[model samples]
Target: MSTNRELLFKYRKEGISDAVIYFALEECNGFDHLLLSQNLDKDIKDENRFVDAMNHYINGEMIEYVFNKAYFLSKHFYVDNNVLIPRQETEQLVLNSAKLIREMFGDKPIKIADVCTGSGAIGISIADVFKNNKVVLTDISNEALSVAKKNGEGLNNVSYLQGDMLEPLIKNDEKLDVILCNPPYIEDIKTIDEKTWKQEPHLALIAMPCTLFYEKVLKDFRRIMNEKYLLAFEIGEDMEEALTKLVKQYCEDAEFYFEKDMYDKTRFLYIKSANSYTNN
Candidate 1:
C-alpha cells in the first residue's frame, strides 16, 4: 500500500506539475485538505481513481477531460471527449461580448448567435450573464452540440442549433444582433500534439485553408445578420493579416479590430457595423 505523499512524489517525479496534482486531489476528495494534510502518510482510500487520473495525465490527457468538467467565467461546465475543453482565453470573448451587448443593446432584448459553439462555454456564459438576451448555440457536429446542450441545460435563454456555421440561421431566416465564433483556426492538423490529436475531436480542431469558416460566414453574413451587428471571433495569431484583408473586402462598412490576449498575442477579432453604433 502506498502513502498519499509517496504516490504524489512519484507523480511529481514523472513531471506532473503541483497545480495539476492538487487539482486532481481536490476533484477526487472535494476539499478535505485538512484530512489530506493529517493523513499524508495514510493509504489513500480511492487510490485507484488517483492512479488512473495520474496515468492519463502522464499520457498527455488534459486534466479537465480527466475530471469531465471545466471552469469558465467562474462557473463549472460539463465537458467530454466529444467537445473541446473550455479555454481560459475564451473567457475574454464572453466578457467583451457581454460588455458590448450592455452598452449597445442597453436593456433591450437582443438576439445573439454563437457559431461553432463548443461545449456552449462562450454562448451559454454570455447568456447566463445577460439574462435578458437570447442566445443560440450552433455547431456542425451533433456530438458537440449534445455536449453544449448539456452544459446549458439549466439556462432558459440558451438554445442549440446543429449546422455548419451560419447555415442554420440562413435557412431559418434568423437575424442576429451579435454573432460570436471560436472556429477551427489551426491551419495544419499535423502541427497539433499527439495527445491532443488522439484525445480531441478532429472536426473541431482542424480548419483546412484555416480561414474557410470565416470566409464562409463573411460571404453569407448578409443573409442572417441585421443591419447593425457585431461579429466576434477567437482567431489564431497568424490570421491577423489575412482576416484584416477579409474584413476589408467583405466588411467594407464595419470597423474591425484585433485584440491581444494576456500574452500580448493578437488572438481576438471584433467587427462592428459602423452605421449601427450610436452612443447611447
Candidate 2:
C-alpha cells in the first residue's frame, strides 16, 4: 500500500475542488498536506499529502453516508439515514406557504400544520418567519420525529407530534388556518433517480403516486379543514394539471389558485378555503 504521504501528494496535484477537499479533511480524520505543510513560504512538494487525501476521497471512504447537515434560511439542522435530508424544493414549499399566509391574513397569527415534517425543515422555517403563528409538525416515523424534535426544540411557537399526518391534528382539535405538506409524492419509485432512491428515506419520498397524497389531503381537508383554512402542497414534476383537477373537483369554490416556486419544474399549489367559503 502506498504511504499516506505519497497519496496526499497525488491528490493535490489533481486539483480537487474545495468542497471535496473539505470532505476529505472531514472523513480522512486529517489530511497530511495541511498537517505536514507547516513551514512558512515553503511550497509543498508534488505528489504530497493533498494528493493522498483526494485518492482516499475517490476510493470513497469519506462519503460512506449521506450529508449530515442541512441549512435552511439562517440555521443548520442535523440529518441522518433515519431522517430524510431536507431538500431545496421543500424549503421552497415553506417559503411559498408563508407568503400565502401573509397575503391572506396580513401578519395575524394563524394555526399551521406541516404534514410529513421530516427534519422539521418546512415547519421550523415557516414558524421562524411567522413568529406569532403556531405550527404543528407531524410525521409517522419516530426516527423522523426524533430529528424534528431536535430541530424544533428551541424554535418559538413550534409543536411536534409523532403520528400519521392528520391524525395528530384531529386529536388536537386543530382546524388549521394553513396546511403545508411535502409528502411522498412519487408514485412509481423506480422512476426516481437511482442515486436519490438509494440515499433518501423511501417512506419520506415515495407514495402511491404523485397525486395520491393530494387525494388523501382532500379527505383530510374535508374532515379537519375549516372555512378559513388554506392548504398548500408540493407536487411532483408535471403534476400541476392533475393536482389542479383534483383540487377543482373537491374545492370548487376556493377564492383563487396560485402557483409558487415558479422556477421549479413543479410548483406548490395554495387553495384558499376561506375564499371558497366566502364565495358561497
Candidate 3:
C-alpha cells in the first residue's frame, strides 16, 4: 500500500500541484492537508479512490468536479459537470450582496432568489448566513437542480425551483426583495480554455454577446421583483458598458453600479430600485 507521503511525492513529480494533490487526498481520505501532512507515513485511506481521483485530474477534469465538491464562502457545496463550479468572484458577489442586504434590510425577513443557481452555492451560502431570510434557488437544468438539492438538503430557509432565469419565480408568483444571479456571461466560447470548455456545462456558459441572460432577466424584472428590491449579477469583466446600457434600458429610474472583485476586475453588477433604501 502506498503511503500518503509517497503518493504526494509521486504526483508532485508528475507535475500536479500540491494544492490539487492535497485536495484529492483530503476528499478521498477524509484527511485535510494538516492531518495528511502530520500522518505522511500512514497508508492512504481508500488508495484506489485517491488514484482514480488523480487520474481524473490528470485527464483534465476540474478538481472540484472530480470530487463532486466545491467551497464557496467557506462552505462546502456538492457540484458536478451539470453545474458550473462556484468561483471566488462569485463569492465576492455573495459577500457584497449579503453586506448590502444587512445594510438595506437589517434583520427584517426578506425574500431572496439566486437565479440561474448552479450547485445552489450562492443561495445556500446566503441562506446559511441569513437564517431569517427566505431563499429560493432556480436553475433551468434538472440535473443541475438535483446537485443543488443535494447541497441544500439541510437548509430550512432554502427552496429549489427549475426554470429558465426568472420564469419559475414569475409563474410561482414569488416576489423577491433581492435577486442574485451568476448567469452564463461568456460571449465567445473560444475565450474559455480547452479544459473548461470540455468539462463544464455549456448551458451555464457561452452566453452569446455575454449579456444575453442579463437582458432576459432585466427585461422581465418587474414580473418577479418587488417594488422595492435589489438585483445583483456576476458579470464579465468587459461587460460594464453594455450592461450599463441594458440596465438603463429596463430600469431607467433605478440606481446601479459595477463592483470590482478581489483581483480588481469589474465583475459584479448591482441594481437597486428607486424606492430601495441607501446608506447614503
Candidate 4:
C-alpha cells in the first residue's frame, strides 16, 4: 500500500515484470526494503540496486533472486540462480507439444522427452496437462538437473536424467514419442550476441565452437529418435536457415516449421521424423 518511490529504484532495467514482483510481495509476504537490501548479497545499497543486481545476475548469483519465479501454462514455476530464466516465448513450445500430443496420440497416454531441460519448464508444463503421459527430462549440467528436479518434484510419470545431447536418452531404448528441446542455439555472432548474451551461463547458451547445439541434437536425432516420433525445439529467429540445414544432415525428409511467439518473433522450431510423419 505504500507505493513508495524508493521501491521502484530497486528495479531499473525492468529485469522482471512489475506484476510478478507485486504478486511475489503479496503472496510471499517478504518485501521489506531494509530486509531486501540487507539480504540482497553484493547488490549495491545505492539508488540502483536493480543495476547492481543485474551485474551479479550476470555473474550468476541469486540476489533478490528472492522474488524470482515464472508462470508457465497458467501454473507457477519456481526458478533461481542455477536455472536460466524461462522466456515467455517458451510457452509456444509447450503449447505446440500439447497440440502434437493431442494430434498424434489423441486422448491416450503418450511418451515424450524434453532435452536440455532447463528447470524442467517445458516438460513439467506438458506433463501437468497430460498427467497420464510419460515425460522424461534430460539436462547435461548437474546444477541444471538439480533445478529441474526441484521444478518437477511431485509430478507423476516423469523421469530425470543427466547426459549430453542424446546420450542420456538412449536408456529409454529410443521409444520416446516426442522430443522437446530448447537447446542452446544462440550461435556465436562475434558482434551482436556478446552484448546481451554475456549474462547467461556460457554452458547454457553457447554450443562450443562452430557447432551449435541444435545442429548436434538434430544430427543425432536420425540415429536416436524413435521411428514414430516428433521433435520440437525453441529456436533463434535469425538461425532458422542454419537450423534447417542442420536438420537436413540426418533426415532430408524432415519437416521444417516456423512458429511465431507473442512478440511476433519466430522463436520455435518443429520437425517431424521422416520415418514417423509425412510432410504436413
Assess each prediction's global lDDT (C-alpha) against the native: 0.86, 0.70, 0.89, 0.69
Q: Across residues 147-238, which tens digit of lDDT does each residue of candidate 1 receive? A: 99888888899888889888898888888899999999898777898878888888888888889899988988888877888888999889
Give all TM-scores, in the order shown: 0.90, 0.76, 0.94, 0.75
Give me the overall lDDT of model 1. 0.86
lDDT for each residue of candidate 4 in 148-189, tens digit (9 for 90 to 100): 888898888889989988877775565677889888765565
For candidate 2, what is the TM-score? Answer: 0.76
**What are the root-mean-square deviations of the candidates from the true structure over C-alphas?**
2.6, 6.1, 1.9, 6.6
Best by TM-score: 3
Cα-lDDT of candidate 2: 0.70
Model 3: per-residue Cα lDDT at residue 72: 81
List ranges where model 3 is wrong by over 4 Å.
Answer: 278-280
Sort order, TM-score high to low:
3, 1, 2, 4
Number of backbone-clashing residue pairs for each candidate, in the order shown: 0, 15, 0, 0
Clashing pairs in 4: none
